[model samples]
Target chain A: MTVENLNNINNNNAFKVPENYFDNFSQEIETRIFEENIKKQFGNKNPFKVPENYFKDFKSDISAKPKSNFAKIIRITKPWLSAAAGIIIIFTLWQFLLTGIENKNNQTGNNDSLKSKNNIVIANYQPEINTVDIKYLEPEINAYIDETDADQIYEDVNEDNNETKINSDDETVYQYFIDYADDNDYTELLAEL
Target chain B: MNAAASENKISEHISNKNFSEAFNLIVNQYKERLYWHIRKIVIIHEDADDVLQNTFIKVWRYLENFNQNSKIYTWLFRIATNEAITFINNKKKKEEESLGTYEHRLSDTLESDEYFDGDNAQLILQKAILKLPEKQRIVFNMKYFDEIKYGEMSKILETSTGALKASYHHAVKKIEKFVKQY
Candidate 1:
């Protein structure tokens, strides 16, 4: 087939259509218009509505306010920056928590070993103290004394006619230190301090 | 219809405040032509119906503002053309497709449309027309199908006669090539 042969081709189209389509189309449009008039008489209320003053301010909305390039860059990057800041905060806190837990575990393990070695037999009990080691252990010993159960120790001392006054409920005056602190939250708190 | 006589009648009826009478006259005079024009642009009977109705509604609203210097049919054709183009643009935008894709979709619609009356050769011609760029398609349609003059097309499309002639010539060559291959 060539462009020259185009004039020889049939002009009639092969598309099919329903019967009386054009005749019915005019009637359909008329019906649509009648329905529209009826709807208008009922009040031309738009079934769909937009925000108040939307159409009124639509033109102004079209012309977006000019933004500085710096502001545009900030707008683009703001969400990512906030997300990174949140991640950094979480990571820093996680590292701090892990360090605290590790220090507490080491301290508790050392105290448990020392206590096992220092236990008295009571059958033929004798205590030995090394003066040089005492200097090395001074801070631990003072911390232990400050954390002692004053009520139980004082009760024992008073019943046995010793001279010490202590109140268990006064947290500032009496601190109870449990060896190993049950290896739970108390040890973490002591390590944090 | 005598363009001058109809314009005078329309103007007289409007000036006399006989709006419905004037509108009826306008519809009777232009409806079929406008329907066919819109039909070619939209390629579906239902869409043409909607656009025709909208064109009239717009004419009704803005008829008083009609510039008396131009022919009434030209003015009506211009409105019909804009309404049809707007309808297509809005439809395409809603579907999120480009104009080329939208035209292909219209060709598909032509095949399935219950009211389409064209045969295979006519369908092939329409498909070829759809493949042309939108401006050339319009130029080709007006020139080849409707036998509309370039001068009148210039007014309706707001394009120069020389450009429209060139567009129509290119469109003819492309369509001929397509038809030959088909």
Candidate 2:
């Protein structure tokens, strides 16, 4: 077409700006720059990748790894197990204490019973001395009296108590012998006298 | 269950000396998140897996020492983050390279990695990220990819929020400039 005809004709090929294009031209350029900068720095892509099923198997892999001995022990020994062990130890100690106390009590009871039995024997034996035959003891008593020093016996009795004197009566002598002699020795001495 | 309730239950289980069960629960709950976090740091699937396992093993060893002062996930993240960083440092030491040289070499290896299935642009981004200072790189990945909040990150990285913000800002600027130049 001729130049004059082209100028008169409608030229749809001519460049045109969209509505308000210039109004936001600087803002638009800034936004594009921002986006382009971000894209250049950190493209919308993850460079790192994993083998397929890596995450799924990771747990098993970690679990399969051996643990430290202390960790293993910690894992194996539950709280209840430790508590139970503590309880058993305490119970064993309690039982030992109870058995010790019981044995001690048994020993004390035996000693007390032995003492009571000895006391009973002494009580039963006392009457036997009273029942001794005086007739069988008369000759021994005469011989003993012949060998004895009556003056020394009176002196010993006077030393025991200055307020009292040895009496010549047999009842007074027998009473003095009973008061001053051992159970078996007194019986023999009394029989001889 | 809510986080507090779940934490309380786990704490109860641990306190009750049910270590196996408690540990199992912990592993199931945190393995994926930790694996991803470690993977981003180490940049290799196998290394990530190893670091993740080490992190969990540490958790198993020190689970009793967890005072519950922070969220369980935050504590876990801390362990995972430290393990990843340690793994990288050890690798760098083994290679006998400076930090920048080792990171550059590691980024170079990403192309041949069988598990790295990413676009060229993504690879470029990752390489740019690796070129950053270690702390800045971590802060960027955690804040950018993981979108972990600054507060939570403070607990995990043991850095003050203000310092982390500054680090992140610097990292983003450096990364953008690098990517634009590339």
Candidate 3:
């Protein structure tokens, strides 16, 4: 028969099914697909295996309290702790600065006190002039002056006149007399005049 | 209960400051899934255990910051994935090996691992899977093994759905070619 004549044959009469085959047909197809998938994936087996009781023990292993709780607590409090520490540091620095300033002020006070003490010491200080010894030596000096040669005395007097004139021109005669004469020297000089 | 209601309960517990109870619930809920995910990535039981513990520790430490914007499981998975990848990179660095050399070494380690119980075909398939780049390997594992939806994978991986889909497709193609050639 030609290809067009072959189409006239009905193939529906050639096939029969069990009574419930159509009922489970979709489920059977799904089961087959699942089986095929399993076989393709791992030949219906898991290639990777675990030790027996591994999963059982793993739950406890993982569920045990983590040691990082302490770290978390620290992390939570870290900012507050840092702020407190910063405040402490600033306080310490401020106190240090205050102490340094106080120390500087105390040293300045000490130096000023030392200067005042030194001025008092200098003001209270006196030289030993020995006015009694000078008073006793004056009469001997006048006697020795009287025993000198008259010409020598005259030359000395002339030199003294020139010095006195220069001193009187520049300074007051009372200042010169107070500087060069004692009390006994004035009486002897007046007697000679 | 559904994930939303369960998540709500956990969130309530956290809000109440019942951290210990909330953490226990989270650990019980996600430990197996996260362990398996990390196992596939790191391929060593010990390494997976370490990464799983680290992932949970991170969850515990950061649980207060969880705004419940994303599902808790997704957040856990993200932490687990990052921890696994970082663990691998750190191991690679510690070994002072180049990427190719490190991959080779990892393959050898898989062969010698006492915990791996796969048959020869499974081993061959695993080896084929391992041939993929790291991101592709993760994508393939999440899609094929975990059977996670693209939307969930996107959230966990912080990737776009379109990009994840393309990555999965390319990964499948590569794995298929590798398996066929093997």
Is model 2 an incorrect, acceptable, medium or high docking prediction?
incorrect
For residues A1-193, what per-residue lDDT tens digits would candidate 3 score against the true structure? 9766666555435678766667756655654454354358556355788889888766533323223322342354323222222222223334445544232113323322111221112112211221222222233333434564434433443364465222212123223323333323422221111
Better of 1 and 2 by DockQ: 2
In candidate 1, stretches whose alpha carbon ends up further than 4 angstroms from where it belongs are A1-193, B1-4
Off by over 4 Å in 2: A1-36, A39-41, A60-193, B1-5
> Can you give the DockQ of every candidate in the order shown?
0.01, 0.13, 0.11
Model 3 segments more than 4 A misplaced: A1-44, A59-193, B1-5
lDDT of 2 by residue, A1-193 (tens): 8987877665655678666667656654554464468765556566678889988877633434322322333354333222222222223334445544232213323322111221122223343332222212223333433555545444545555664534544345444434533334432222122
Please give fnat for model 3.
0.29
lDDT of candidate 1 over B128-177, digit per residue (tens):
77899878887776776687888899999999876776686667667666
Q: Considering the two chains of model 3, state its CAPRI-style docking category.
A: incorrect
lDDT of 1 by residue, A1-193 (tens): 8865775564445766666666556654654454343323332221122235532332211012112222333354333222222222223234445543232113323422112121111101212211112222233333434565434444543344334323333321212211112223421221111
Q: Encode model 3's per-residue lDDT on B34-81: one tens digit a residue.
A: 988999898889888767776775675566578767788888899999
Pitting candidate 1 against candidate 2, the one with the higher TM-score is 2
Range of the 10 consecutive residues with the lowest summed lDDT in candidate 2 chain A: A113-122
Candidates in order, TM-scores: namely 0.47, 0.55, 0.54
